[model samples]
Target: MATFDARQMQSLTGLQATARTFLMVGFTVVETVALGLWLALVQGAPVISRPAAIGLGVLTVGLVVEHVLTDATVNGLSFSFPLARIVGISVSEALLWAVWLGIADRLGGVDGILVAGAVLSVLLVPQHSVEDNILRGEAPLSNVVNLNTIGFSLVEGIGATVWLLLVFEGQQFAGLLATLGFGGVDPAAVGLAALGIFLLVEHDIGVTLARQG
Candidate 1:
């Protein structure tokens, strides 16, 4: 058998790593474009669907941002948001507290209580405020739509992952184990999603600009 030196092994591993990066990035961009083309083709005739398309586009953007930027970038964003996020934090925090209290009994006593708390902690608070801050358009609900779509997409993705995991061999796959094993991340998808979102937003903005022109 031909033997690889340490440098050769490193070179081979680097090649594989570079290949995965290219593939992942390509996948994200392709998926984003595919979805946009799909939506445009299917709903091109309907005026009502334009908003939906934009909302979907924004969701894609959030996915890209979160995916590419990672937890680190988002957390770092906190420092710059003091002025913009104050109302979101205050109002959302209060609303979160209210919902937590109102649903306490419905949430059941011990186990259910924790579940209800989890909903508030995990799902309820951050997004509405986030949308509220970004909603600067004449279309008042655009931000809300963007926020909810993002939340929904993420939920869908994670749910899909879990459902797959529940099946027999998902967790056993060599690739899956290798990726998860190394704590490797999918920054390509993140970049792709971000690029898609930007394209979508630009499209929307372009349409409006052309109309004005």
Candidate 2:
């Protein structure tokens, strides 16, 4: 077996890296367009015609395909840098949020943007804390999904699900929250959920970080 120098290894992986970058770009575009179209229809925009809706559906399918392909490719290729892997995930998540906000903008505008931002900010806190530890070498990257990661995933998933439901079907769920007397979008609910999640996982890294100082 031949040994690869740093330059040689980079050259060999260059094509795969380029393909991954292009895939991410294509996925972002498709997600943005599909989400925008779906939200438009949900909001009764009258902007999406029949053919446009069909095209959006196709693009959404492509998004799913891209997600699977991205995971497969990344895991299949032996990447050298842990930081690179983390950064790639971070960029992908940022792109996802960008597309989400694009859809929210179509659905509601500035209010939608603010609500989405707040929701994402709160939801990502615990996960970010764990990730911060991992990136800083305080936590082992090989043990990425420990109790903290698992807890973060659960909280994030639950909070995000609630937020999405409110954004897409707030009117329907208004009856459920009738006792709260807030009939429309409730940013407060999402904020509270996020806060609870943050507190739940705070011990994982927050206490540790505090004690270190």
Candidate 3:
């Protein structure tokens, strides 16, 4: 809710941002593995059986909508162009929060967070295969999608860290790492491993991985 002139963030975080790329990728790999192991369990749980998959399907749609909404939320109609993304973002956020909370009650909130973190990890890091995908006409990530996801994740990480620093009392060492946790990661196999879990969870390994000799 704080107003940022934008310049300050760049100065405060460019180096960290560059470094986070690597971290994000690493985080993604860990998440992929965790999800694979957990998805089957979650599906079999009494509370989540069948219905949870339906819920996840809904959440996936929400993720796409969140993309559109975030833009409208951030850059509203200026004197020049009316960015209508805010409405979408506001709605998406509310829905995701509600869905996450509801599902978390049964599914372990950590899983929800993991899913979000994993998705962002994939979108955040710069992957080499994007070019191959674009050429193949499979699923080309547009510039807008990539840019907005990066901006959103970067700001969200910083904002949450600031809030934690203010509200929570903790050791300086713990705080430092927590503050830096939103750090990004590299866009290599590590990052792929992280995100690939989601694909695998949905039984779509072929989508995440391409045969390279």
Candidate 4:
């Protein structure tokens, strides 16, 4: 039998964390591209290249895998401090959406990217809401449960809104708007639509959950 010393175990854990982070980043990219392709195809736009299309198809499988892993990893943590868990989960969700924004901007223009992200956000909001319900069930008195859910939700919403303004208001922010195909219709209108869709989906989930309970 082989055993690891304290330092060896620490090193192994570090490597595992690094690997998980990389996987999160990679899968987020895959999901973003897949979403953008889906939107483009639906719009009857022959936009994505053949190579990009093939890569995105293969990467689509990772979306579910990554989402499951993220939920499990956060719920599996053994944090003695209440704040640790809240912070961990909050940061994880924020970073996940941040990666989505970065990749979306690369895949399409700001408007298209916002639409794709809004779709992804709507798709995942129910999953997170379910997770929140499970957590409340397990620890009904835990304020951290509510805090984590609300905090992460706020972070995601604010992050997306800020990204929309940064990209659409002017190219001076990121300075890549032209290259990303962000110049057809009014980007401001697209941003507003994205924000409205996100809010509507989130509100719908909340109302459904409330009725269920």
Clash count, one per candidate: 0, 0, 22, 0
Model 3 Cα displacement at 191 (Å)?
Answer: 27
Predicted structure with the largest lDDT when compared to the true one:
2
lDDT of 3 by residue, 6-91 (tens): 77677667755444344334433333443333332343445446655554445434443432322222222134322233233334
How well does candidate 2 score on lDDT at residue 120?
57
**Least lDDT summed over 10 consecutive residues: which range in candidate 2?**
202-211
Stretches off by above 4 angstroms in model 2 are: 1-8, 45-63, 77-112, 124-213
Q: Which model is ahead, 2 or 3, in terms of TM-score?
A: 2
lDDT of 1 by residue, 11-129 (tens): 98797556544544443454355443433333323424665446444435434432232212222223343332334333443344334433544544444444544565454324432
Sort order, lDDT high to low? 2, 4, 1, 3
Clashes of 4: 0
Residue 107 Cα positional deviation in candidate 3, in Å, after optimal superposition: 0.7
> Candidate 2: lDDT over CA atoms?
0.47
Candidate 1 lDDT score at position 109: 44
Give stretches of model 1 more than 4 Å off. Answer: 1-4, 44-213
**What does candidate 2's lDDT look like per residue over 89-114, in tens digits?**
44444444445445565657445655
Q: Please give the range of 10 consecutive residues that has the lowest summed lDDT in model 4.
A: 38-47
